[model samples]
Target chain A: MVTEQQDYAYNSKIEGEVVVSKADAVINWVRSHSVWPMPMGLACCAIELMGVGASKFDIARFGMEVMRFSPRQSDCMIVAGTVTYKMAQAVRRVYDQMAEPKWVVAMGACASTGGMYRSYATLQGVDRILPVDIYVSGCPPRPEALLDGMMRLQDKIKNEKSLYQMKKGREDPDHLPTGPR
Target chain B: MNFEEIFSELKRKEAKDCDSFICEGKDLVNTLEALKAKGYEMLIDLTAIDHGVEASPRFSTIYHLLSLGEKNYLRISVDCEAREEPVVPSVVEVFPAAEWHEREAFDMFGIKFENHPDMRRILMWDEYEHFPLRKDFPLAGIESEYPEQDVVERTDLKVKAAPMAGGPFVADTAGPMSQTEPMAKDQSWTESKPKKEA
Candidate 1:
């Protein structure tokens, strides 16, 4: 079969002919592979976030080394600590500015559900302000847990209706609530 | 001079606690001036305590002074005379650093520091209605919309009071001693009082 160029009846190699994939597959593949993260490192969990980016853990293996400070530049917002009532407005303002097709990773107990800080000053959870895609547990999760959450987020992205639907969902975010899933 | 010499110079009797001495509201400025001459250089901290709304001399403005030069400390306690609208003389003229401390005392205990350059609440915003540190204030905070009129105009940023959610919970008995010894213990509150289980 390898020697049969004239026969066309069948080599495993399709030399010069095009290979096809769904638009969903290609775009999601590209987007999932190169996720630019906005690190909202407000407290102790921020140390662990830095650890993920450091050489020992090497977040670059997933092609996510670029940590964008600006909300517009990043695709993922990793809220890594406590969200106080005073700070919720600022967080919402940044979330509003983040580009469409954005995803949020609520890292650690504090960012997810106020952890032990259930008080008047602390916002019970960040979901009070922004929609979260993944909730990674741990008081301050080890770097491995965050990486696993990232991969889970990637898996979620790969399964989306993709492209047009995501944009339409953003426009009518209320109607098509990107609620938990 | 040591605590004994300083007290003797000020014509004060020995306090039960040698480092601290009590003074009247009218004599606050005079005592502070005399202590400054005695070389207690810094007004380290000033705070006020509310004995009770009903108690005579309802507030006590406590000052912690340090002589950075002498390497010693002195505490001066002065009672605000009026029970209802307590006012104490400001010491900013003598210490300059007492400005913010006086503001903090006023903010927390409602003990007005008379002749303070700017008499406003230091911790709570200008429009905040309640003195949070008062005994009557609830453990769970009060709910209000934006504190500033300008902030209301700018955005619909609502800072809601934290929900109790059957929370500020009684001791989660399973947890270790470090976590749950002192739960939100009081039964009554001046604000949103927690409902009884029954």
Candidate 2:
């Protein structure tokens, strides 16, 4: 099984072609702006995540209203709760399902470090299974914080001319993710 | 243990090892038992943490131990170091109700008891990979199942079918008419979907 870090490091193999021109930047921008996220809520933070989607927070401003139920169609995965060892593999599989150029956002402390359940069951962070692009820090980050993280992600997207090309030197298909098999 | 007596005894013993009190996690289990021997048996609830931006030692478990006899309560706590394995002793043997409560602790916080008899996943399936209750556990949850039809359907139909038609009122559908149907035919009802006309 692919451990979380291995997915982001220098060894992940590139199975697809890289997008390497100015045009790629525009496409990436469109994709990033029109993000269709999968909100996989687990704990209390889920409530806040709902708030972000609620009329008050209105995540639709970022075009993430699709809130995909199937991982294959989502552009990014926003992990909003604690991830236990039992759930780690499943998270990885969902990450795998999303097509190329997919991103992951670790939304809260629990998604970042297993929050309060630092024991035998919970995985310290979702990063242990999937690559995280931006981290929104909070027990449950305020809706404003989530918006800021999205803006930062957009900034990151704007700067990159090619998502695949930027990821070039780090590709290694043969390398397996580093956690439990 | 009786809270009044324990408090008074604790004061007299001046247990130097015990200083300021902050109840937490599994420690509350032992503290409760020790208090119960003194007569404290009413447990209030479990409280937890979601340490964010505070720098490590992310979560804390709080247990409220109370006694109906003396009508007193004491708080106990255990700190789960960030990214560290948290383990505490079992109080299940002491309190029968603790069995389920401890399981909830395990299911949510991922805290493990030293000698839990059935130390398996309770809320998340055995195959499920995360302790969902932890503050840092991903919100998107683990990926394997997204509202699995079987699991969600079981409970959801009971709830959803109430307000509207096409609800999971399968038995209600056939009701008296189905009872008259042959026993072999009745077995088909167990299938989630209705049989298609050949």
Candidate 3:
């Protein structure tokens, strides 16, 4: 729920009127909720990622159920597998292609640090190539864990200073991360 | 999948009667030529084994052949007598499928297949130098660079070795048995440890 102010007093009325709030708060809330994820399922860990999207776990609650294959459409890159050396270039290219105000989630142990494969082929961590905002641990992280990560990302997005907020001469407040819930 | 059991069964039933034999490296082309003349017309698989980097005959090129008409199987083991850079004659001219197989073998074990049309690496990138399957190649890998980063070149995109931290292998031996067995104190391949300049 948005914080109440003099401009937002109409929202409290019966049959609630127009809500007024900072552009940062509104845009961040929208961006956080409807984070269309670019699913980069490279290995076995991707199975767990799929479970998050499916009805059993239901990623729809967080509004990230749209697993966009194309990088252009998606705002979040959930790299859900082992990033091998051969695939590193492709991953980087995809990350670069994605539109700005994008976030990356290194899902599962492999995507975080190569997991059991301490080998020549696998890239040590996806962060070695992509700028990761969140890292979900576990061999294949449970769907709940992924949801938790999504919420954490949402919290991060909520705290970020949007362009409109910056243009309004309002500097980003150095506030400790507050949970969206 | 149970090779020992299958081999034992084959041995009991006289495997030689099936016409599966291990041939020398020099005789590979001749053996394939003769096998093709017979009903064993298909080259099913071609792979290589690394004996050791130092051994006299360090590499062995293995070929599996199959015949639909005769319902027969032939496996040939061609031994190459060389320690470094073992060379085996490519059977691609006779069996077309051997081309990729030979390239894969070269890519993994550094075994050169003579007279193959394209002898470049089949799996790893063209610039990748290491024969990963070689005994000397470490599991944690070697530090290397990726030169193809053209999009956003902010930091130097290098392929760093995985931080093994020597877990499960290197244990804290100074502690009591109970403590030492459960947790590992890094001895080698640690992030905190100072890296040697290349």
Candidate 4:
């Protein structure tokens, strides 16, 4: 579908840049092309996760169709539910089990702050147990919102920081952001 | 019967601090039995709420009773202690729906339903440290991580029955931490030994 001139312009741009390391190129390509997500849907927010998979949203366009149920195989964990005290430890364990370079996205108000259902058993937010890289704020976010979060996570991956470094930066008590999400 | 009649009768019984025929908790059970004697069936949801600020009893239990034959609805409520675990008599034998509703209250409010078949963690995992729904508990997880020494000492955490609240939520049997075996576990960041400064 590319015209001859369009292809030439693309190649010239690539040639003008300094050569990228083979490993870095592969990693860049992989980060964008395939994002294996773990959809940890537990509450009403789970319905939004479903919307992201449906044809209207078509998350498959981003090549993130395969949702790994086992924590070990997943590239990132999307906490899409109301986490309770009973569920916090389990969430942390799953985050731990995920291989290096894993990401976590906290989806919805309930997962972020217990929402209106705040109660004795409801853990206020998931971030206490796992470091949340991106937060999709909504009572339950729209499908596009979830996609936006994933895209932001992709940007985080492009930086090439180890998962531990990224997590520690977020956890640093002194560096907490004062601005709104 | 009209609410006025019930209210007057409750007033006569000298139920202290009684207000406007709002029958709750133990009083609710007694009223339900009296209503059942008059042939009522079907108990609806059992729910509780936490008022968040300190009070003598910072919790309330709500019970809804229905009569299919007569087509009447009655609501009863009781104020009780917001203990780490509040104990209320189970109405499961009286109505099946109460089983799950009580469990839900326990799961969310940390209320304990006495005589319930099971009483354990419902909405949360087994190793979770604090009851989150309590007004005092932060909406977020507790500020500090589980201490390393605490994990080491918990080699004998017991496995209990599933919570009475009947729902899809289940405790991960293979929990994040093994209740029986702690020595073999890796030191998670929450419990990691502090780094040595140069």
Question: What C-alpha lDDT values do all the predictions have?
Answer: 0.78, 0.63, 0.77, 0.65
| lDDT of each residue in B1-198, candidate 4, tens digit only | 665564443422233432224544665566666766665677666788787666656777777667778777656667775445567777777676777788778776778888888766665554556665677764323443333332223221122221212222233447464353222233322123432334
For model 2, how does the per-residue alpha-carbon lDDT over B1-198 read when each residue is reduced to its tens digit?
A: 434455432322223432325545434556566777866676576545546435466666655667678676555556665454567666667776666676778777777766878777576556555666666654434334423443232222111100111222233345586363222323342224544445
Can you rank all candidates by DockQ, best first?
Answer: 3, 1, 4, 2
Query: Which scores higher on DockQ, 2 or 4?
Result: 4
lDDT preference between candidates 3 and 4, better one: 3
Please list the residue runs of candidate 2 whose C-alpha ends up more than 4 Å from where it truly belongs after superposition.
A1-21, A163-181, B1-198
Model 4, CA-based lDDT: 0.65
lDDT of 3 by residue, A144-163 (tens): 99999989999999998876
lDDT at residue B136 of model 2 (Cα atoms): 63
Error of 1 at B117 (Å): 5.9
Q: Which of the two, 1 or 2, has more DockQ?
A: 1
What would the per-residue lDDT of candidate 1 be over residues A112-147, giving only the tens digit for each residue? 987767665676678756779999998799999999
Q: What DockQ does candidate 3 score?
A: 0.36
Comparison by lDDT, 2 against 4, better one: 4
Specify the CAPRI tier of model 1: acceptable
Interface RMSD of 1: 5.7
TM-score versus the correct structure, for each prediction:
0.72, 0.44, 0.77, 0.58
| TM-score of chain A, every prediction, order shown | 0.86, 0.77, 0.82, 0.77
